[model samples]
Target chain A: MTRIAVSLLYAGALVVLIALPQLISVKYYLHLSILALIWLIVSQGQNLIQGYTGYVSIVGAGFMGIGAYSTTLMGMHLGLPVWLTILLAPPMTAVFALIVGYPSLRMKGHYFAIVTLAFNLVIFIVLLNFTELTQGEAGITGIPKPAGWLEALNFRDREVYYYFVLAVAVLTTGIAWAIVRSRVGQILMAIRQNEDLVGALGVAAWKYKLFAFVASAMFAGLGGALYAHYQSFINPEVFGVAQSLDAILAVIVGGSGTLAGPMIGAFIVIFLPEYLRFADSFRLIIYGLLLVLATIFMPRGIVGLAQDLGARIAGRR
Target chain B: MIEILQQIVNGIAIGGVYVLIALGLTTVFGILGIAHFAHGSVSMFGGYLTFFLVAGQGIPLVIAIPVALTAGVVLGMAIELLAYRPVRKASHINAFIVALGLTMMVEGLNLEFFGHEQVVIPTSFDRVFNIGGVTLPELRLYVILAAALLIAAMTIFVERTKTGQAIRAVAENRDAAILMGVNVRTIPLVVFAMSTALGVAAGIMVGALFAIAPGIGEGLVIKGFAVLILGGLGSIPGAIVGGIVLGITESLAAGFVSSAYKDVIAFLVMIFVLLFRPQGLLGKAS
Candidate 1:
């Protein structure tokens, strides 16, 4: 009953937020919403590895880049359907993640973070230098939007695309929540808390970390595909370290270990800059200051804070 | 043979900068168990300050570097005191988050003060020396010398001095160091100041040899961490060797193979090392 009530509240909030772009009629807000949705998906993906499994991946944007470039190239060159490209991109990203994560994930904690950070750097360089395939910094432009069966309904509109992205976002979060609540999530948390103990229990620790890493990559790829199709342009910069850090920041600030945390984190990280447009230059200072404060004061994140308040109220009762 | 030597020389010069950056990071991580992500940005800030002093303020490169290094020391101390000290005993994740935040703040501050334009310090040493057909730039030579000097100085400080012994004591066992009258709290400040000064020196080298921009620090920090991992975290000797190894590999890969694959190849090597030897090249197996 509580879960249902909580989900309903989330649905209501999501609906209100989705309706906002339409009601405000501001192109900027629409753009911001689209960005938020992109970050929402990315943050959720990051949460899978960082929050749920307790492995810090600083390369979320690299996976997103793979998805973006794969979808863009396939859609543009191979003349594949946008939808098909979206479906295929995640697997492609997963394969890359598996290869990279195989050895990289063996190193726990700070070592893992460095490895992922290296991955991000390498991926960015590849995207920038592979001129023949990636168009070298010029970026692949004029990516086609979803058409055919979906196009028959005139889903080309920004509002329509917003709804489409929100639907995927909802579905992805649902899947994520389900996974986190399942046995796999339990195993993941166990690994996070005590990998040696998990290994003693006969669970192949590396296998589970690898699984989480690939799954996280798939989510990043899915988000990247959506972003590519929505924006109709892709660049090397999209997969750079800054974007990856933003994803990690979103996961951290949103509240790790909770479903709603990444979503809220995505909202704040993506929307905060938009809202604080007047402080343009000093925006990063504010962001940095906020992150410091959040880490110190609300280490459990906003969701954790809310839960703490609720627990206090219940205790008083 | 000549080409290999040239690449080796090139790598060594670049490796010197990496060594300085990694030294700062290694000290902090080794002593405090905190990942100082902001070290790169702070280093860049030092570089930018040096550039401003040289070009904008009309100070000589020699005078500007010391000023910037001093500023770096102060900034490092300030970060430890203001940003990290309060959350020292908190969760490791707290320090991690603060590190990320401080990285952004420093990068933003650099962007604001330096503007978005890339700045390079104008040095008088524009001459290139041809040693056995391997062209070595004068500025790069100076960078190598300066880095060696700093490394030697740091080694003496850590190995010979009483304060350095205290730092080593603290790193080995914090509680015991505290009991032994090591003044554990002041150690982090000292570590940060030294580290930041080294990072500033590297930044100045980059400014003179390459350039300084907003996101460059982020890239440098990543590389520094890579060196950290490759050398074995918290090992100063490992940092030096790892930085050189990474720098040489990157240059050789870029020169021989594809520049695009330089980073990819370097990381692949690190990954391979980690798979076979998880403790890194110099790191002891826990």
Candidate 2:
């Protein structure tokens, strides 16, 4: 059956991912893969809100910053274990999301997008100016990776961290898959289709929206925490509006409204730049043009395009 | 009292710039219902162009201003025809996505052409007039005057001209406007042209008053949107009042409160407006 073939393909892809670090000789590519995986986590969360719920929250990077800072600060000040700090990041990020989401979720469409962008700027500003805590633009260096677990496997190696991130990415993707398949996901999609109608049908639409927003923020937080420990450095620069735009780009380019889209998008947004070092200066221009052209010509993204092609070939047979 | 007056004067100049940016945004949002997020980046493009003309190419400031304005108009038209027009009938989100893409493209183009370092447009108006303990620089005075003149011109165009009335008609009811023999196709172009021109003027003012750098456009555009929300989405008068209020609030906040969090205060004010009066100050409750 086609279902069996699809599952086999999924299994094959997982196998390749697990073997990627070993297969590639260059340690740098492993670093890039880890980054791509991190982005995958963030974009999956973005997909829940933007792709499924039909709300474009532009503060993905900001929430990531919150998660990153929470883990770092707790370790620095409270002397908590790195593992515990990372675990606490999601709940901390979710609390901030609730505060932001409650007031912002009232507005629909462009209003919501703009409000979230403003919040992103607010986050960036605080990180930049709150020098006593965040160290401003200089950022916190020497962040400890989660150690003391599985002593045989060194966490310092890029390959070890790669597997760790891949596991988290897979788990989060599975969670996203579950959410999309559940009854709650149906209502979220309904809210996307026609929120007013959902409310008219006596559904508490705002609650669903808040849930999506907070859930998305938690994903960003987890991604940020991992990024911090993996890189062993934390800075506000990486967690600005630009990175949030990258999250949006990942979802849109990879295929919004599709489970596989963010994974594909995460790689493209991260690796495309790495390969385009030749056109260093024109990179952003080209990157932007690609986004515009892709949105206009291939709005459904690569996954959707593949689906259409598959249907056509199957029909021909 | 003198310090307050000084702060108000300082705020007014920047506020004038905000008003122009918001005016440009409101016209497009009002008529086409597109957020046109690229307005700010494109405005920065104008500023960069003017800086190149005056500082790099040795052109006169007077000549450079008009040249940049013309380029903005042409660019605006091209944007509508090429980028936005294709996605016009798609879901509203598609247009916004296109707008976001356009913003990045324009921003990237600005960086590639202008380089990363900040540039201030050279102006010879160096005289400062002290009026009862509140000093007003000659450059700031000219900026305020130019902004006032431009705003007045925009008001007249929107209020009195036939094309303006057509624009208003389309904004009020697109299907009705089409039935009434208004050329809906041309309206978006005109609105973009006028809006871009207004934005270019703001950009030039900003370049002269402060400096035009890579990230400044994004900040300006966000403020412009805040003004849009504060004034009321799609309300012209609301943009004006909202721009002024935001500018003054920022000035006072910086002067009295922590200057570091001035931008935060502006956003907070915007959030406050959204919470209490989502319709905006002059906007009708929908």
| Predicted model with the maximum TM-score | 2
lDDT of 2 at B16: 90
TM-score of each: 0.96, 0.98
Docking class of 1: medium
- Give one digit per residue, the lDDT tens place, for model 1 in B148-256: 9999999999999999999999999999998899998889999998899899988888888888887889888888988989999999999999999999998999899
Runs in model 2 lying further than 4 Å from the true structure: none
For model 2, give the RMSD to the true fold: 1.3
Provide the lowest-lDDT 10-residue window in model 2 chain B: B88-97
* lDDT (10s digit) by residue, model 2, range B12-98: 888899999999999998887788889999999999999999999999998999999999889988999999888887666778878
Candidate 2 on A56-118: residue-level lDDT in tens? Answer: 999999999999999999999999999999999999999999999988998888888889999
DockQ of each: 0.78, 0.76
